[model samples]
Target: MADLEDPPVFLGFDFSSQQVKVAAIDGRLDVLHQSIVHFDSELPEFRTQGGVHLHGDGLRVTSPVLMWVKALDLLLDKMKTSEFDFSRVRALSGSGQQHGSVYWRRRASETLSQLDPDQSLHQLLQDSFSVSDSPVWMDSSSSQQCQDLEAAAGGAQRLADITGSRAYERFTGNQIAKLRQTRPEDFQDTERISLVSSFAASLFLGDYAAIDYSDGSGMNLLDISSRTWSEICLDAVAPHLGRLLGAPLPSTSVLGPVSSYFVRRYGFSAGCSVVAFTGDNPASLAGMRLQPGDVSVSLGTSDTVFLWPQQLRPALEGHIFCNPVEREEYMALLCFKNGSLTRERIRNQCAGGSWEVFSAALRDTPLGNNGNIGLYFDTMEITPAAVGLHRFDSDDTEVSSFSARVEVRALVEGQFMSRRVHAERLGYSMRTRVLATGGASSNKEILQVLSDVFNAPVFTIDVSSSACLGSAYRAAHGLVSESGVSFFDVVKNAPEPQLVATPHPAAQEVYPPMLRRYTRLEERVLQQRPT
Candidate 1:
């Protein structure tokens, strides 16, 4: 352990939808203190009046870019008040929700300050796209975009063959295409495009345009083997868009010192290095201290399962997202859009009302709901192949009419079974245990259900902010001599987990039939043409 007098403190920022969580950890990966600051643009005063439009994607509202600037400012202000010395915060890094792009025109002396204050630039680009809001990863309106790309690249299988992944509307490539096809003027004006994670880092470092491989891979334009934007992808996309795609940097690269302006504005120490940023999923994988055969299941706004692969293999019928870990090391990933939200909806409408009552009802429902029903949770399942939208057939149409207990059970069971099929398709055997994290994993009933469904031990770590903790681990390992201490050692030395849930035998016996039903439903659903 390092001495407390001046031990290095690695700071990790998790820029989430609900809150921005900032955490600091010492050299030994011990938590120092953490702060969560919340902000909402939905307030009447914060909301824009005439400039916004309710696009098919969602609300296309424009706030002055300064809102983000002020939000970060307030976040730092709160951090300063917490008594944690900003100087001790040596290296800084972050994890953000994936796929949202921040565009900027390249110009010397146009620091983030100038960029932030320039409402005209935002308005100019906004007018160009005519769609004010950037389509976040959660936005699924890119169905048309996905279809076009699939047709152009010779169907889903062919496109997956070239890019090593299927087309998803949330991917940077599709969003760029959407802008180019619909808003040519805006597409031409875009000088550079960046992911949200890299954009936040650029705020501190001033001019760096590098994106971490983890976030870059999510763009569906990045080549997994080369770990760079694919020329083929660029060629396919560049004709429609104008901005130059940036090269991907390793997660550990020192971006540069915090901008002198930011240092003065936020009272940060000089020479504080800002490391490259990654998506929350990759960061969470690091936080969970994942190893080969070790899977990390994050149950956030969405649900994701990540496994450290020995090597990259394009398996799982394109359900797998393969990206680099450090250098040659890679990660295999599966994400579900409707995870906790589905469960919450069930609790509210079907499970006798309230989460407490839902848990009690689930306990009494017995294994497999006595084989009377199954659930089809499809809140988010765009990846592997974009299904466009949910459409329950004649038989399932009644299932969607109203929320019922059996229907909810079917939805939950269906989602878990979908994940199982995905895992199996990726050539992952059932021997691996799952390390579950996020809000959903905290619920005892959900964990038990997951345990029984997957038939694998589900373990929850002691730290709630696993992504931040993992980023801290990466930052600390990057600072000291490589030979002195290893990244694995940092993970190994981290605190013990909070709980472990093993599968119940009765449920385990019942899962096989449920799994078969789920496979049939998924196959039938995917095969049917969208109405």
Candidate 2:
């Protein structure tokens, strides 16, 4: 056994929608090596008689098993070519996108030796469920199902109060209920269901089912206070479905080992402990070294502004999601469905050809675009939850036409202001600092707007893969059995941040009125919607 002073090297995996990123960290908390493997999106193929079917998105439609074997094959090949030793790897774990479920069956042969690398056991379970693809977190087809579950569990508010989130379409409970209603035969076939994070961990350990608190919290089946599945809520849907759900494991629990088969195939040494998994957001927070008063704004396809909170509270009326960091620690998260993609669209349409040109245009344009007569960037309104709400309102007297520069600034400012309002609602004071990540963090213009809107400093780390690093940190912390170091200690001493942006005092005054106007517009739009 290694001495407590000689902490073992750990590997963390971030299983994202676009790609799989693998990162390794040494005992001193230095990132040793990192690699990213991209997977082509499974395009929907139309079959005249069979209807439309999608394939090749990391799974077989017949069994719905995650085809990480292919992804792992590519990753391991890369590692081998790079001459990264797998033998010294002491622990492994992962951070995965939340809300996805994976199902697996326990092999009859309990011995670790019987778990063959080439076994197609997942295929044999086809008769159990017709799950074709592990529904990615981005799949929102279960909206109606979410509504049903909300009603079943006692209205949206009650469900939010209990689960710490309003039932989302992609959440596990809604997805399970949808499966049960649409394909009763398949639902009955399911022996066990697990989140993608847990499933990835299982792959390394040869265990079929186990869930981590961070990922389980996103399921809409978990009781926030108890940190367990809600029996009353489960019974409201179906007791059988509840039986299929896995128990929630703490973030620090050591699930098992990298199975011998995996060890042999990947060239990793035996006894490499595999820690339980967690959701990507909490992992990002850990990676960024977030503490009280530190806010991280993750701007991916969907944008989420998360901050550590002093107390655990349910999501407000419109906002519904909680941080799964720990039972006592709280995270207030504000999410927007349209984030980077919307910004990209605007860049393509208005910024001519380059981000440099866009930045230059934004810089040349004065604060508030010289009090632009009729300019506002919608970028999808946060309130009223209406799709395509980014369009300009003719009734607003602000602007008649927007220049390319004005349009760019409006989009940047809109997103920042949204974060500001969300943080305020969460009871964060103006003194809080904002730490930014994801695609938007790369844009200096956006960061400036973020700083100005929040009237706080914005810091960006050099590492693009914060979520993966966070996962590795969790794995390392989980491996500590004897007087090990804390996660905060690890991250605090890990690396130095690169860029920091301070708020532009001149623009601070301009943003407050603009934010107020934006809120009014949002309310009007929602009120006009037909109930």
lDDT of each: 0.64, 0.67
- The TM-score values for the models, in the order shown, are 0.79, 0.82
Cα RMSD to the true fold for all candidates:
5.7, 4.9
Q: lDDT tens digits, residues 1-531, model 1? A: 223477778888876544567888877777888877554543233453331223544623222333344456567767768766777778888877677766555442254444442232223232222223555665556677777777776677666655556787777787777777777776566666777778667776777558887777777677767776666566666663323566778776777787665565555667688888788777877777777776667787777777775545564254334442456666777767777776777677776657777776667666675454443444426443434334242244424343355555555555666677776665456446778787877778777877888888888875478777777777765564235555676567787665578889786679887677656666666666464
Q: What's each prediction's clash count? A: 6, 5
Write model 2 residue lDDT over 95-138, tens digit each, in one string.
87777776443331243235555543333233332454666665
Model 1: residues with Cα > 4 Å off, grouped in runs: 1-5, 41-65, 108-133, 141-144, 162-164, 239-243, 298-302, 309-324, 337-351, 354-373, 377-414, 439-445, 462-464, 480-486, 505-514, 525-531
- Global lDDT of model 2: 0.67
Candidate 2 weakest lDDT stretch, 10 residues? 43-52
What is candidate 1's TM-score against the reference? 0.79
Model 1: ten consecutive residues of lowest lDDT: 121-130
- Give candidate 2 regions above 4 Å deviation: 1-7, 41-66, 77-83, 105-113, 117-132, 263-267, 300-302, 311-313, 316-327, 341-361, 364-384, 387-399, 402-408, 481-484, 506-514
